[model samples]
Target chain A: MSILKKLPSKARLEQVKKLSSEIFGSTWNPNNIRNGSKILRAPLKGPELVNYYGVNDSMPTFQDFKKWFPELKLVDPREAYRVKMVEDRKKRNKGAPKKKKE
Target chain B: MPFRFPVKFDIPKHAYVNARVLRDQFKRIQYADNEVTRNALRYLARNTELPAKVRLEAQLQLTSMPKYTSYSQIKNRCVATGHARSVISDFKLNRTAFRERARAGLIPGVTKASW
Candidate 1:
């Protein structure tokens, strides 16, 4: 019945992942890896989970990490680079929003 | 050196309600119901305000009480009430992601280059 219950899990996860990536600066990785996947998955635990939960001193176990992010995959650095480049290119083409002259 | 006596302090019931009650309640409901409730509880439990309120209540209770409770005591109650268990299944379900992120540098303080 609480407001928190209404948020979509997938959307919430995405938001958390974005925040986690920002705070951890890409240091978050699940413990699984596949040779061809575009994403890197790491078990969420210890400091990472604590950070994600927004708790100052709580430690999250591997099991805790798994519960929150289910779509995690091993992100190859090369693949990540490729993805980043593509995204950057798209952003550049879109260009910054035009500033209004005062 | 003189022998020092250990001073014990207790946390209040309001603190328990604010810091721990909602979570414990949600977990209880989540476990007692089916998948839908479980999923709903997971989302509901994420509310930042709820936990803060609980904590505030606990603080108030602690300030007003005669007999004080320890932090561990509060934690044990939460665990005993099954608040901590709801997420364990979710954690197990998401283990793959955790592993993947670990392999990558997505986790803070973990280097990506090392296998």
Candidate 2:
């Protein structure tokens, strides 16, 4: 889209939360999404003691979910990351002491 | 999307349908321009007896079309969020949205890696 957001915002978050609920509502509980992973033990007397599973369940990384929000106007991370890196480098070097001459 | 000038239409990306329409329209323009250019060149190539004046005129006509009609000028944006950059044409989503939706199981079979 023409208008691209460089950073995440509350509006984007709210939008995706609504979407996650809409898409996953039939299958998952919203409360369980952000609860992180859990271990489920095999039923009855099965030899499989425990099955380690569920990383954020159906929920993706907080920032990663913004991709699905049609109105957020997100930009490519490649360009955003590059711009961030350059800005960071400039900031990091701004206060450095001058090198001594030989 | 932006206004695709010389085509007398705006690329309306505020909404998904409009964006899609714009992209499709530009693609059609691109194809038509290419066909026109190709046919003109073919006529020039096959007509050895054609006068130099007509041949030069055909070449000029081919170059006269706006570059905006070319497909390369068009970019795919995520239909959901209207996000730019790294839009996967197959998925019609930006990288972030694709990963999220795929993880959410909106897209079949593909899942996100937790590690």
Candidate 3:
């Protein structure tokens, strides 16, 4: 299954869609298929399953928009921070000692 | 995110940042939650005629993971105010906060409805 090979014709596309429908029934999310040289997209499916079973063993993924666009830098603040939970507790409860001194 | 008590802060910036961190923490552990149940179910569903004792053990393991880890535990709250109950998806704010902001023209292209 050389999935990298482009099937650029209506006859080739129906063949792939038929094959994929047989393989993955419910979980087969499809793709937006395009027509050649016209700014047009035909409603279609089986691209995801084609990529999944044909190219990749696992599921296909959404394209990484952050890599494509410089402005959208995704960051999880948890990576950039430490809360010091024990210190926060001590400061919050300074009047009443958290632990008894021996 | 719902595991942590809604953080109340005098400053909106502190509250929003704290909530964001908690939400990210929730995302981190979510895989573990799904993995525990998924593996257990797979053992039951895919395996053929496993010993009753082993199946029971798998069920027990699935039940043992914290209730907090369940998908139901994650909640959307207003990032600005930490209001939990009625947060709307579009602006991520509870109705009260959304109304205030929309009325004040803080949220672009949204206007309060009058009947």
TM-score, candidate 3, is: 0.39
lDDT, each prediction: 0.40, 0.54, 0.51
lDDT of 3 by residue, B1-115 (tens): 2435333212222234454535533442453335445444535633335666766676676567655445455565665666667888777777998888988999999976779
Across residues A16-85, which tens digit of lDDT does each residue of candidate 3 receive?
8878877875322245322121211222222221121122223322234435565777553554343455
Tens-digit per-residue lDDT, B28-92, candidate 2: 44544465454545366344457778767766765675655443555556666666688887777
- Model 3 misplaced regions, further than 4 Å: A1-102, B1-55
Better of 1 and 2 by DockQ: 1
Considering just the first chain, candidate 1 attains a TM-score of 0.22
- DockQ of candidate 1 compared with the true complex: 0.01
- The local lDDT score (0 to 100) that residue A101 gets in candidate 3 is 61
For TM-score, the strongest prediction is: 3
Return whichever of 1 and 2 wins on lDDT.
2
TM-score of each: 0.16, 0.35, 0.39
Q: In terms of TM-score, which candidate is stronger, 2 or 3?
A: 3
For candidate 3, give the lDDT.
Answer: 0.51
- Give RMSD (Å) of candidate 2 vs. truth: 29.2
lDDT of 1 by residue, B58-87 (tens): 456444432222212222232122243323
**Candidate 2 ranges beyond 4 A from true positions:** A1-102, B1-55
